[model samples]
Structure formats: C-alpha cells, structure tokens
Target: MKSSNLLGYAMALIGASFFSLKAVLVKLAYLPSEGANVVLAQNELEPITLLALRMGFSVPAYILIGFWAWRKLADKPSFLPVVQAFALGILGYYLCALLDFTGLLYITAQLERILLFTYPIFVVIIGTMFFGGKITRWSVLAILLAYAGIGVIFAGGEIATGANVMLGSVLIIFTAFLFAMFQLFAKGLINQMGSWVFTCTAMTGAAVSILLHFTISASMGEGVAASLDLPPRVIFIGAAIAFFSTIIPSFLVNIAIDKIGSQTTAVLAMIGPITTIIAAIILLGEPFGWVDALGTAITISGIALYTFFERRSQPIRAIPLKT
Candidate 1:
C-alpha cells in the first residue's frame, strides 16, 4: 500500500482502539471503589453527570479547533448549514451519548460496544426505507448475519439474566439508529462546511446541550454538584474519556477518511469492538465466554461483508466521525 494509505490505516486502528476505551472507562466510573472514603464514589456519578464532565472538558478544545477551521475557510459558509449541523450534533452526540451512557449502567461494556458496532446495519436499513436506496441480496444476508450474532449472544442466557439487559440493549439499538441518521443527514453539511469545521461545530453543540442537561438536572436536585466533586482517579478517567476517546479519535478517524476513504476507514474500525472486549476483560473483569466470542465474531463478519458489498455497489461517502 501507499504511504498515505498506511498512515490512514494506522490512524484508523489507533482511533478505534481509543474509541473502544470509552465503554471501559464509563464502566470503571460506575463501579464503587473499595474502601475509598471519597466525597463521591464512582457509583455515585450518574450518566448525565459523567456526560457533562466528558463534554465539559472536551468542548473548549472543539471550540478552538472550530475557530481555527473557520478562520482557514476560503469562503464563509451560510448560517443555515451551521444551524443544521448543530441540530444534527445534538441528535448524534448529545442524545446518542445520553442513551449510551445510561445503557452502560445496565449492561456490560463488552455488550455495549458490540451493540453499538451494529450501527452500519441500521444505516443500510434506514437508507433503504427512507432515502430511496436499494437493498441487494448481500444487504439482506448481511442483516441476517449481524442480527443472528445478536441472537446468539441472547441465547447464551448470561446476558439475558442480567437485570435490565434488554432495556440496555434496546437503548443502544436506538442509539445506533440515531447515529446512522446522523451519518446520513450530516453528509451534506460536512460537504457544505469542511469536515473539521463541521465536526467541531457539531461537537460544540453537543457539549452545550449536555451542559444544559446537567444544569437542569442539578436544579432538580439530582446531586449533580456532588458528582462533579470527583476523586482524582475518577477525574483522570473522565479526562481520558474526553481527550483519548472523544477528541483524539474524532480527529484521527476524520484524517483517516480523508486519506484512505471512509470505506477503508470503516473496515479498519472493526478493531473497535475487539478492543473493547479485550479491555473489558482486562480492566473490568467482564466475562468473555465462548458464546460471547462466537457472537462477536459473527457480528463483525456480517458488518465487514456489508461494508465490502456496499462499497462495491455505491460510491464512497464520508463516514461521520463519532465520539
């Protein structure tokens, strides 16, 4: 492969690895620390509170980057596209993140990552149903394979027995749908304003929305203030989520797409679920039985097949950078 392609692949791999860490970190943040007499243990921090922290630390960087991109623009984009980008950002990041974080409370991080990884299948389904896109036989087969993997996992009985696992799985499935919609709708805006500018703008919008959410919840006496008074280790984990998972991967994936095309970048991103599985096992002591292994393999293979066939039939388009 060319040097650019090689670099792009490297970026994608690294970005996916970083992105995979988000689930593990969130899980870590949820676990109560043993014998730590801190003001607030990890379990005390709610999803909204954690989301607020993640966005709070990351937004300033996004604003600075957006401003830089805006300054570098040869021509100023219209206000309408900017507004639309903001709305899409709320849908994609703010709402999607809220649901994801909440779902993680009820499910294992490994399962959460696997479910989220199925977003592409939702993309294909949504595209066919609403966007006048045609579904070939390969698409149908891909869908079956992906869902079959999910079914296999459910069949394992371990996940089924977990309290609210179904609820968590449903929430994540919806999150996947919203993310797919964001990917489809945000393409035009990304074209209108360049990728970096569009991304930063969207992320800033998400950050603002999350802060507002936290503010509202705090006013309602949800212990939001107490959650913010985190221990050093939790604070560090939050920062890692913001910088390592959200900001860095966002830029890396974008750069990868620019270099090697979204199709290739996406293929490289298959590393994400695998990374999450390993991290969950090592960090969270999550079980990874044969059933989990088989399901994950099936799900990934299905998505990969779908991507390959989708690229063959359609022209390459930009993959939306997800936080």
Candidate 2:
C-alpha cells in the first residue's frame, strides 16, 4: 500500500477503536444505579427521549465543523446529495442505535454487541442480493461461524435460554441488518458528495428525524413525557455518548474512509466488536465465560479469514482476432 493509503488505514483503525469504546459508554450510561430508593430507573427515560438527547446535542457540534469546512473550502455545500446522505444516516446509524439501546436494557452488553457486530455479514448478504455478487462457499461458512458465535454469546452460558433472551438477540441482529443498509445508502451518497458534506447532512437528517419522532410521539401520548427533573449524571452521560460515539467517530471515520476505500474500511470495522468485548469484561465488569471467549474468538477468526480471502477477481478481457 502507498504511504497515504497506510495513513488512511491507520485513521480508520483509530476510528474503529473509538467506536469500539462506545458500547462500554452506552452500557455504563444506561445501566441503573443500585438500590430500591433510587429516584429514577435507568430505563426510565423513554427510548425516544434518549434518541432525542443523542441527536439534539450532537447536531450543533457537527454544524460548527461543517460551517468551518465550508468556509475553508470556499464552497456552498451541495444540498440535495447531503439531504439524501442525511436520510441514509438517520435510518442506518440512528435508528439502529435506538434499537440497540432498547435491547441493551434486556441483554448483556457482550451478547448485545455480538449480535450488533453481525452487520458485516448482513452487508455481505445484502450486497449479494442487490448487487448481484455471488455468495461463495467461503462467504457462507463465514456467515455461519459469525452467527453461531453470536448465538453462543447471547445464550448467556446456558444453551437453553428462554424467549426474552431470544427476543433481545433478534433485536441485535435486526440492528445489524439496519446498519448494513445504512452503510450501503450512506456510501453511495458519500461517493457523490464528500464525507464532511455527507456526514453533516446525514447527522442533520438524523437530528430532525429524532426530534420529529419525539414530538409526534409525545403529542400522541407515546413519547417520553417531558420530565422537569433531569438528573445531572444522566444528562452528562448522554452528552458524552453523543460526543464520543456519534460526533467524534463520525468525522474520524469520514476522514478514514476518504483515505481508504470502502472494503478496507469495512474490514477495520471488525475492530469495534473485538475492542467492545474486551472493554465489556474490564470496564463493565461483565463476565467473560468460556462460551463468550470461544464465541468471540471464533467470530473474529471468521471475519479475519473472510477479509483476507475475499480478494477481487480481475474482469475477463475479450480475445483479439488473429491477423
């Protein structure tokens, strides 16, 4: 690889590392404080409220960056592509994040993470379906290994678990799929519009979508009621998440992707789950049982194999007629 490409890969790795730490933060923030006398339940803030807080607070930070970039470049940002990119971000990253957070209330962070990390498998499946790529034997094997690891981790050391476990696991899987779709759409838009422009627009889309959803849900009695008593810790943690997970990683990954093409970028993304699992054990004090260890190793191994093996084949050329 060229020095520039190497630098881009390094940037992508750094972004992935930051993203990996996100699961740890989200789990910590949403996890309830102990004791029956605690005034607020961890899950008390409605899911929409959490989502709103996430996007609402982060939007301004991104806007400032976008404005700076625009002024520096001496260009009016293109509106249409940016909007489309925003829609993709809202649907892919934000919506999926909402689902992941909700599911976290019911599942172990490690298990939930394993399920969410299946996004790469979903990406491959969706790519094959829509883009007409063949799912080779290697791809099939990789998918099975990855999902089986998820199953082991999600079962929580008992292979025979109940319905709630299954439900949360399914939610994680769905989150992964949604994010895969997000990537497809976002990357398409990014190719046309630069990453900064694309991310700003997409984050705006996400912010507006979250706000509108909160408003409509509240109006319909489905929203998190406006609480006059906002806990300082909850607010601070929420802001931390928005800043670290979405705002910071968004720009970093954008820069990384600009440096490296999509394929290498996606491969580096595997780092998130690897880092998340370790962080879960150390930071969250989550147990790393035999099942968890084996499963994570198996999953990461499969991903590495797939990444190493999935080399692009050169297109066939037509033969020239004999003179």
Candidate 3:
C-alpha cells in the first residue's frame, strides 16, 4: 500500500475504535459515584444532560474547523444547503442521539451497539422502498442474515436482562431507521457543501437543539444551575466522551474517506461493533455469552456482504458522518 492508503487505514481503524467507546463511556457516566463529595447520584444524570455536555465540549471545535473548511471553498454554498443540513443534523444527531442514549440506559452496551449496527441494512431497505433503488438477491439474503442475528441477540437479551431490554431495543431500532433516512437524504447536501462544511453545520444545529432541550428541562425541574453542577468524575467522563468519542473520530473518519474512499473506509469501520463488545466486557462487565458471539458474527457478516454487493452495484458515496 502507498503511504496515504496506510494512513487512511490507520485512521479508519482508530476512528472506529474511538466511536465504539461512546457506549462504554455513556455506561460509565450512568454508574453511581463513590466519593464523599457526591453532588448527585451519577445515575441521576439524564441522557439529555449528558448529551448537552458532550455537544458543549465538542461544538467549539466543530465551529472552528467548519470556519476553516468554509474558507477553503472557492465558491460559497447557498443558504438552502445550510438550512437543509441543519434539518438533517437534527434528524441524524439530535433525535437519534436522544433515542440511543435513553435506550442505552435500559440495554447492555453490547446489545445497543449490535442493534445500531443494523442501520446500513435499513439504508438498503429504505432506498429500495422509497427511492426506487433496485434490490437484488444478495440484498435479500443479507437482510435475512442480519435480522436472524438480531433475533438471536434479542431473544437472549430478554431472558438475561428482562422486559426493559425490549423497549430499549425498539428505541434503538427507531434510531437506526432515522439515521438511515439521514444518510439517504444527506448525500446531495454533502456533495454541494462538502463534507466538512456540511458536518460542522449539522453538528452545530444538533448542539443548539441539545442546549435548548437541557435548558428547558432544567428550568422546569431542577433549575439550570443545579443540573450543571455535575460531580467532577461525571464532568471528566463527559469531557473524555467529547474528545475521544466525538471530536477525534469525526475528523479521523472524514480524513480517512478522503484518503481511501468511503467504501474502503466503511469496510474498515466494521471493526466498531467488535470493539464495543470487547470494551463492554472488560469495562462494564457486561455479559457476552456464546449466543452474543454467534449473533454478532452473523450480523457483521451480513453487513459485510451487503457492503460488498452495494459497492459492486453502485458508485461510491461518502459514509454518513457520525454525531
């Protein structure tokens, strides 16, 4: 491989690893703090609050980088693209994130990641159903394998984790659906505005939405000051999430796409769920039985097969930027 290709592969691998860590970090933030100076039970930290903190720490960098990206463009993009990007951002990042975070509270991190991994499958289904995109035998087989894997994990999860797991799984499935929609609609805007400009705009919009949500909720209940008075450990975890999971991986994945093309970068990103599974096992002491292993392998295999067929059938498009 050339030096650039090597760098792109490395970036993709590292980016996927970082992105995989978000679930682990979110779970950690949910754990109760042990120190004497505990301001609030860590478990009391709401999903919206954590989401606010994450966007708070990361949005500044998005703005700065976005400004640079805008400056680099020879011709300015239209205002309509910016508005459209913002709407897509709200769909992809804000709403999807709210569902994912709340769902994580109920499900194991491993299960959450596995369920979310099925978004690409949704993309194919949505494309064919609504966009008149052609679906082949390979697509059918891939969907079967993927859902079979989901059924395996979902059945096992219910027995092990209880009824709440079903609710969480449903929420995450909806999140995946919304994300698939976001990816489908975002391509034109990304092409017009460029990835960096579009991403920054979308993320900024999500950040604003999160902040407004936190403000309204906090004022109505605990008051804004009280909500912001998080314990030091919780604050640290939020910062760590912002840096390791959000900011770094966002830039790395985009750069990787530029260097290696989205198809190749995407194949490399298949490592994300495996990374999450291992991290959940080690860090959160989440259960990972034979069933989980088997299901995960099948799910990944299905997605990989889908990617292979999709790559052959269609021209390459940029992968959706993760929020």
Candidate 4:
C-alpha cells in the first residue's frame, strides 16, 4: 500500500478503537462518582439524561463545523442538502441515539456494540425490501449468518430470559435499523454536499432535537430536575463520550473512507465489537464467557463476509485502489 493508504488503514483502526470506547464511557457515566471515575455499585443515572449531556457537550462543535464548511464554499450553499441533512439528523442521531443510550442501561456493553454494528446488514435488508435493490443468493446467506450469530449470542446467557435485556436488545436492533434508514435516505446527500458538511449539519440538527427533547421532558414532571442536575463526574464522562467517541471518530472514519474507500474502512471497523468487549471486560467488569467469545467471532465473520460479497455484487465506484 502507498503511504497514504497505510495512513488510512491506521486511521480506520484508531477510529474504530475510539468508537468502541463510546459504550464503555456511556456505561461509566450511568454511575454516580467523582470526575473520570465510575462506580457501578450504584446505577443512578438515566439514559436520556446521559444522552442529553453528550449532545450538550458536542453541539457547539457541530455548529462551528457546519458554519465553517458553509463559509468555505465558493458558491452559495444549496438549500436541499442542508434541509435533507437536518431531517436525517433528527431521524438517526436524535431518535436512534436516544434509543441506543436507553438500551445500554439494560444490556451489556458487549451485546450493545455487536447489535449496533449490524446496521450495514440492516441497510442491505431495507434496500432490498423498499428500494429496487436486488437480493442475491449471498444476501440470503448473509441474513441467515447474521441471525444465527445473534441467536448464539442470545442463547449464551441471561439475555434470553431477562425481560429487560430482551427489551434493550430489541431497542438496539431498532436503533441499528433507524441508522440504516438514515444512511439510505442520505446516500445522495453525502455525494452532493460532501461527507463532512452533511455530517456536521445533520448532527447539529440532532443536537438541537436532543436539547429540545431534554428540556421538554424536564418540564413534564417530577425527577426531572434531579436527572438534569447530574454530578460533575457524569458530565465529564459525557464530554469524553462526545469528543473521543462521537465527534473525533466520526470525522476520522470519514477521512479514512476518503483515503482508502468506505468499504475498506467499514471492514476494518469489524474491530469495534472486539474492542468493546475487551473494554467492557476491563473497565466495567462485565463477564467474558466462552459463549460471548464464540458469538462475537461468528458475528464479526458474518459481517465481514457480507461486506465482501456485497462489494463484489455492486458496481465499482471510482474509489482508487491506492490513495
């Protein structure tokens, strides 16, 4: 590989590593503790509250990014892409993020990462179902592989019997589906407005949506002020999640895509679940059973296979083999 291609690979792996830390940090934030410290002994924080904090910390960056990108354009900005980006932002980041964050409260971080990583499969399924996309034999095999992996994971432990875990799993699955839908809807917009611009603007919209949602929910009744007034430690964790997990990884993944191509960056991101599992084990004292190992291995293998075949079946874009 060329030097730039090597850089892209490095960036992808680093970004995946950072992204994997998100769930771990969010899991940490749910506890009441001092700065940068998490105490799992007591689970005191709510998911929406954590989500709102993340958005609150990250919103200014998104707004600045969007405006900076806006000002850089030689021609006046086209209104269509901005409008689409904001709408998609609400759908994906605002709604899906809320669900994902809430789901983490009930499920293990390991399971949450694995489930969330299945958004690409969801994208393909949604494409075949609603759009004119073809479903190949490999696609069928891919679907089977994914569900089988999930089944193994489910059978491995209490996720099968625990009602709360099952509900969280369902919510996360929906989060993945919603994100896939956002990807489908914004495909053209990405090509049109460029990745950074579209991403920043959409995320800005999501941030605004989250703030409004939090304010409204806070006004609705009791326990509102209590939840909103989180401790300094929780807020610190939220900032960590925002910058290290969300904003930085988001941009790095895009840069990696630009350098080495999206398919390659995505394939490399198979590291996400493994890293999350390790992080959860080390950081949160989560169990690491043989079943977890087997299930995660199968899950990653299936996703890699699915990505490979899908790439083969689709027409090649002009993405250079080397940057």
Find the candidate with the highest TM-score and give its number.
Answer: 3
How high a TM-score does candidate 3 get? 0.96
List CA RMSD, all candidates: 1.8, 7.1, 1.7, 3.9
Q: Worst ten-residue run, lDDT, model 2?
A: 314-323
State the lDDT of candidate 1 residue by residue for 1-323, as single tens digits. Answer: 79998999999999989998999999998887665556554446779888988998999999999999999999889999999998888999999999999988889998888889888877877888887778889988988999899889999934434868999899988998889888889877888898899999999889999999898888788466655666777778888899999999999988998999888898889899989988988999888888888988998899888888988998223273385
TM-score on alpha carbons, each prediction? 0.95, 0.83, 0.96, 0.91
| Tens digits of lDDT, candidate 2, 1-323 | 69988888887777777766766776776667554233566677666666777777898987788766656654554777766777786786568777877777667676766666666677678877875556677778888887677666656563224457667677777887787777655655655666686677667777888788777877776434544135566677678778877777777777776777655776787777767778887878876778878788787777665665564531111010000
Report the lDDT of model 1 for residue 300: 88
lDDT: which is higher, 1 or 2? 1
Better of 3 and 4 by TM-score: 3
Give a tens-digit lDDT track for model 3, residues 1-323: 79999999999999988998998999999988777365456447799999999999999999999999999999888889999998888898899999999998888888888888888878888888887677789988998999898888767743237558789889988998898889889988888998899889999999999999999999999798988887787888899999999989998999999999888888998999989888988998888888878888898999888889889988223273374
lDDT of 3: 0.86
Model 3 clashes, total count: 0
Model 3: how far residue 22 lies from native, Å:
0.4
Candidate 3 residue 318 C-alpha distance from true site, Å: 7.6
Off by over 4 Å in 3: 39-43, 157-160, 315-321
Model 4: CA > 4 A from native: 32-44, 74-77, 158-163, 222-226, 315-323
Candidate 4 yields a Cα-based lDDT of 0.78
Candidate 2: Cα lDDT at 2: 95
Model 2 compared with the native: what TM-score? 0.83
